[model samples]
Target: MKAPQGVTLVDHPLVQHKLTRLRDRNTSTKTFRELVREIATLLCYEVTRDLALTQREVETPLEVTTAPEIAGKKLVFASILRAGEGMLEGMLNLVPSARVAHVGLYRDPQTRAAVEYYFKVSESLAERQVIVIDPMLATGVSARAALERLKEAGARDLRFVCILAAPEGIEALRGDHPDVPIWCAGIDRGLDDHGYIVPGLGDAGDRLYGTR
Candidate 1:
């Protein structure tokens, strides 16, 4: 499916192929972890595609040359914890120098609302772009809460990245943070009765960690 404005569907052939394996219920923990990392790397490539670059003079073995280099402060990857960590290493592989911020939120069983327990971010977030990551955009409560907290901590330029998203979650996130662009590998059907992404990879955190 084509992504609407403010959202990017990373539909590259490689991402699609990996995503299929990722969705297979029979995929093992080791393989699932591997696929997540691989797809995360591919998704990171798309997210950083339009980064600003500055030309610099370089002296080659033969002659002087000009090379384009990424300019400005390092980027921030704010992982929404537990499942978000699955994608972190792959993103770090792409930008080893990028600063990492961890934001923790848990949903109340009864309320189904996000509760923030810990929040920490790098200095000068307003000066750098931030990419917030989570494996599933189920209810968007955690994502929305994280965005609010990030904004409060001075994140002006931000984007959201996920492996799968439900239509309800996407709408909720878009309504809350329209300025923050979203990138996802897949957008499945709407949320089910329990607010889980229907036809989605089951319980990403559990699948990633081999936890029930």
Candidate 2:
């Protein structure tokens, strides 16, 4: 399927391999959690590929030279609660100095609407780039709500990253926030009746924590 205009599919071989294992029903919680982290790290590399850089003078063993370094304020990772938290560690492993924001939102089983219970973020969100992380984008309700809240909180440059996504979810997000880019390991077929991505790695929050 053709990805939306602002969507980026990270189809790296390693990422695809890990995602396959992650989708296995027999995979244990421990292994599932590890794969999520590994994939998050790989996706992070793609999402931040265009981050601004500046030249800085550095002294090497042989001589002094100019080197490129990340410029401007540190980036922020906004995890959309429980499932999003599963991707946090791997993202942090890549950008240890990056700031973190948590937007606690849960989907109502019956309505599939998003309910926000918590929100906390670093200062000067407008001055930094924010990447919202969530493992699955099945309905896109929670993601859209989280992004809306972040925008109201002063986040200007924003992006969304996920391990898997549905076409419906991608379209919904782009329709609401066309300027914000999306990066994911893969885009699944579509959502099922209960608002779950078909053949999705089954409830990510459950598998990650052994809650199910």
- What's each prediction's TM-score? 0.98, 0.98
Write the residue-wise lDDT of candidate 1 on 1-212 in tens digits: 55767889988999989989988999999999999999999999999999999999999999999999999999999999889999999999999999999999988879999998888899999999999999899899999999999999999999999999887788899999999889999999788878888788899999999997
Residue 134 lDDT (model 2): 99
In order, what lDDT does every prediction score? 0.93, 0.95
Among these predicted structures, which one has the highest TM-score? 2
Residue 2 miss distance in model 2 (angstroms): 3.1
In model 1, which regions exceed 4 Å deviation?
none
lDDT, residue 157, model 1: 94
Clashes of 2: 0
lDDT of 2: 0.95
- Write model 2 residue lDDT over 1-212, tens digit each, in one string: 56778999998899999999999999999999999999999999999999999999999999999999999999999999989999999999999999999999999998889999999999999999999999998889999999999999999999999999999999999999998899998898988888899878899999999998
